[model samples]
Target: MIIMPQLSPIDVLKRSNAAWLIRDQWRNILEDAYELVFAGINPYTQDKKAPRSMNRQFDSTATASTVRLANRILNEMTPPFDNWADIKAGALLEMTMDKEQIAALDQQLSGVSKLVNILVNSPTAVSARSAAILDTLISGMGVILGIENPEDDVVPITDQAVSQSEVAIEVNARGEIGGIYRKRKIKVREIKDIWPDAVIPSDLLAKLNEKKDPEIEVLEVTYEGGPGSNVAWYYEVLMCAKGQDPHRMVERTYDVSPWTVFRWMVIPGMPYGPGPVLLGLADIRTANKVVEMILQQAAIAMAGMYLVRDDGVLNPDNIRIAAGGMIPVQYTGGNGGASMVPLGTNREFDLGQLILDQLRTAIKKHLYDGTLPPETGSPRSATEWIQRIKDLNQDLGVGIGMMMADVVQYVRRRVEVLIKRGMVPKISVDQLTTKVEINSPLARAQKLSKVQDVINWLQMANAAAPNAVATVANLEKIVAWISSMMGVPPELLYSEEEKKKIQQNIAAITAAQAQQANAPAPSQAS
Candidate 1:
């Protein structure tokens, strides 16, 4: 009676109860479920197991018919086809065939639809398909659940648009948010009145204003320049504050004057042997003896000049040079006659050599005659030695010419004044005589008239003294003057005391010799 035109399996299934059971008409609904089941089967065997049960409460004949129909549907449908059971069951229910078959088909369609729904909605099933489809669906939800692959063109959440009502934010170049300011700027009225004025107590301020003057006063002394002498040596002296007048301070200059008698010891000739013959002789031993004597005299003179007792007046004792000299000069004949010479006095080289020779002879005599100690003996103190040399020079006619004796006496008087003033010590006159003997430049020249040599010798001697005032150029003048005066080397002389001592010693020696000579002839009584 109701003959349904030959319906395609899928079309029949769609109109059946199975299609009503499915919630959504997925594009490949039944086809996808059938493919899943078919793919799950082993291709090596044609006999594949069914995913669902075939036996049901349909008519035995209908069941066979339904199975035959399923087989025919499978044969007719292509790769993408509906589930065979679903199609068969849907057909049976729609045709209202036997009640029992309808009931059974309805129950089968329900189970088949439930299975399709599970497979379609499951995450596991979704993942089983291509991932591109799932990603597209998730991206459409508007929330980025995870990081996109670097190669993808997906924009990040940060790039999304924001509204004006949202908080304004700033990202530093480092990609971090900038924070709030913590410091504020202020304005100043003036810079000049920044510091507060310092307050001073009345008592402290009064003390600062008080004046206290020092008692010491400085004195100035100006010497009138001499007519032909453009040069003058200047010096100073100190006085007690008591009974001192500030106006009289200028007069103190007269108290300090240049020393009149400038003296130095003569180390005559060179020492024995090949070294520089300072004293002129080739024998080093003899020369050394001479040098030692000269040094002794020089030392003594220095001591007397500074340390000897003198009157209260400053005198020559107050005068002192900066330091003793050890400087030398070489002689090369020139317009000036000689390159190297003493700084003061007019003595020539030949006279200097003669004086040195005489000094050497005198020193030798003392050494050989045993009148003085050997060179190695304890030398007389510098002061004693100089005094003695001066004494010897005066007595021996070696110092101060007859005409210059007054000048020498004037210098000695000044030295005496210094002694009386306690400015110099009370040294033995004998010692002073010895120092004068050796150090007197005039005496040196008197003993040797070789003006050039004398000049050289004096220059050398001045250079040897500490703080020598004479200049070599001036020494040349002094030498020239001495030469013009027709001075000759003086003979050795003695003082009365020394003469007495010499006479006594000679007498004793003579008496001994006479006794020896007058002794009875060796007894030859035969």
Candidate 2:
């Protein structure tokens, strides 16, 4: 291996601009998503204000529902401080490694998951990730990007959720992410600290001295490159200021991409996916409008709207109807010539109520609002509870699958950086092929039924014929199944190779006991 040269940063900037133009196709929808579901934090602007339509979402059902679902989604996908994913040894690795390497490999595999957790559980990671998950729900795409942070000894990983507005991605026909381009506004003073390669002008320093802290933009792009055998991800950074040519900052290449892109759904040939919020945006708007109308109706009934004759002295604009306010009216003719007549507040509320309720229910269900069953309802049996969790997970099956897939790639990408940084022991290519099994709360719930099923089967088998139990049940598989269901941390459990060693020990002990039992007592006979 000879390492190939990376593209110049200027080229990176040009390609990124082209991709961003494509992302603009999603600009309007992304704006709508942030308004309705993500609390209007527009990363596109430094002020981060929501768009004006934020007020239009008066019903709040979509916003509330989005938040509730995002939390649940996070807990299920990658709960903070919990072992949400497990790294399992692939079959090839297990069959190849002998007893001596078994314990070492197991220990190595265990540490990988624990260390990855520490990196992800960092304050910044969770804070940003929470937003990214919401972005996934609201805009259909969310991003977890690993950038240089100098303040840390561990993986200088950012936990800040990158706004959709800051990111543009190119996806291939096979649903693989081909490129990721992100732009950020940074204060001139801090640029030197973040990117060691950054150069600051004396003029910029003078501005910083004046406490100006003028903002400069940086465009970072990571794109797939290399011919078939030499395939790799390339990275670049460039200074991107309006009305100026992109100045190259730095460039590099990596075996794995630093970007972890999450999409709610994958539509073939589409560069991005749209989440449930976009699907229900119409309903959300409609519901909000209906509620606002209903409130207006109530206001009209309480503080009656009135019409006055076109009288010379009434001056309708001056009319003030407070608790005890006074209004002067001139009487000039019949009915005082300034008499105010009531404008009818009378209107039907039933139809609006119906539409609103229906929209709310649909929105809540779409967002997985986690509405609990009535506490007054009959208590559920253990079996019923297990089944319920299974049903819920099944309903979330597709989204969960997509999220977990992204997570697997994310973990592997993290491993690439971690190994180079010596944060974790280096795992070979075969080891990297290991499975990333999700073990989140929802996963545990879905697996609980399997555990129950195994237990019930074992109990029935032992009751029907105790002697046949050993043949009917694989003790190792049974225990492993139970452990998975219990959501045991990978660090605390034995790997497949280690379990094989344990089974061998058990078999040896059993064989010895049987041999002793069969052996005759020759000394006693003599």
Candidate 3:
């Protein structure tokens, strides 16, 4: 069992204020930004019980375009782990170890991998929330948390989406996350479920169980340096439970794990991070509105030919219009009738469409639509496809690296929690110190680039002096290097027995060649 220190209500409030203040400051901007991305409206100023109105009658092109970009990005850059089943596939990660340590390392890693699979495969896994948060992130920014005990499921893979408005983060100069304060309104029932065995007053439990529109409270979890002084990381979590005034519930203290907040890109001068899609958001929104407005105006302009009456009896208000129908009207005075006249025979729509296309092109360029794969048909050849993929990757290379880093850190934290909870074998805990290698396509492409350079050099060397190159270089070592860089599993490489036999054969061949060279003069005498 774990123990946490109890905190007075005032102390809880104090600890929460710092985070709350930061959140309040960014909420207005982030809230609106996220709304624009997901809900297609600006909800920053939405009041209680007031119906929110759309600022512009635009469709979800921004949201759809963002989704398309994210899909392409993820597709081009595969996740390091193929799936939960292959978490220990060995293709994605690297570790330094001797022959003797290999078995132990694999065993330890198996446990950790299984635990990760369990966490990631759960109903509320990161994969489930990734699309939503990713869309929000691209639009402006978004936040996601890998909570240990979400209380919604039994398997404990609790990934939750934190509204951008509720999170405040601080990053160091090196871009490492220094601290994070995430405040959310969790229901009382959820709190009870999360801390199932906590010592809560019976009366409070009774009220909570009644479920009469359960009260929600601000549950703030903060992570910063300090606390467990010698440990690698330490953090604190304080909860202000409903009805527990003046004395808040101390969820935990000195959490030995790191924070699970994932930030896509850090804002230049801001204390928190920013989104990739936010850079061109103003242009996108403007173009979307412009298109919508143009469509509406064109429809109004082309409604039909207007009938003008000199008697003023057949005005727009008195006219009853129907598609493919003729209307009958009686003239009130002699020589008074309606004449069908076109609304705007001179009004042109081609210019409006041109402007619309130009605006869309701006949005497409910023969102990287042109660089991504086309919606229909394949590239002419595999080479062409590869080149296109490489181009797309290069476009977002830095951003991809940032995402990979965050994913590694997030997985590390989850593995640590599993180890602490005894879900994984104790032996595997030491392996957590190893660096995680991202095996995503972009990362693989980088490695492939270096390998290709080496191959090219080898070809050039062979062309210059094939015999000398072959004799001077260790072919086995070269093959091993190339195979390793190509992401071949270590288990699939040549066994020790095969390697020994190959080395012996090479030695025999070299000896025979030397003897033949020495005795060549006698054979040439004939």
lDDT by residue for model 1 (2-77), tens? 3223323233223322322321232132222222222232121223444333211111221122233223211221
Off by over 4 Å in 2: 1-5, 38-46, 49-54, 98-104, 148-151, 154-156, 199-212, 227-231, 314-337, 370-385, 429-435, 446-449, 456-470, 484-526
Query: Which scores better on lDDT, 1 or 3?
Result: 3
lDDT of 3 by residue, 273-356 (tens): 556557666776676667776766666565643434445444555455432222334442345444544343235667767777
Residue pair clashes in candidate 3: none
Candidate 2 versus truth, CA RMSD in Å, comes to 5.2
Q: Order the candidates by TM-score, highest first.
A: 2, 3, 1
**1 versus 2: better lDDT goes to:** 2
Q: Report every candidate's CA lDDT.
A: 0.29, 0.72, 0.57
Give, for candidate 1, the lowest lDDT window spanning 10 residues: 138-147
Q: Which is the winner by TM-score between candidate 2 and candidate 3?
A: 2
- Which candidate ranks first by lDDT, i.e. highest? 2
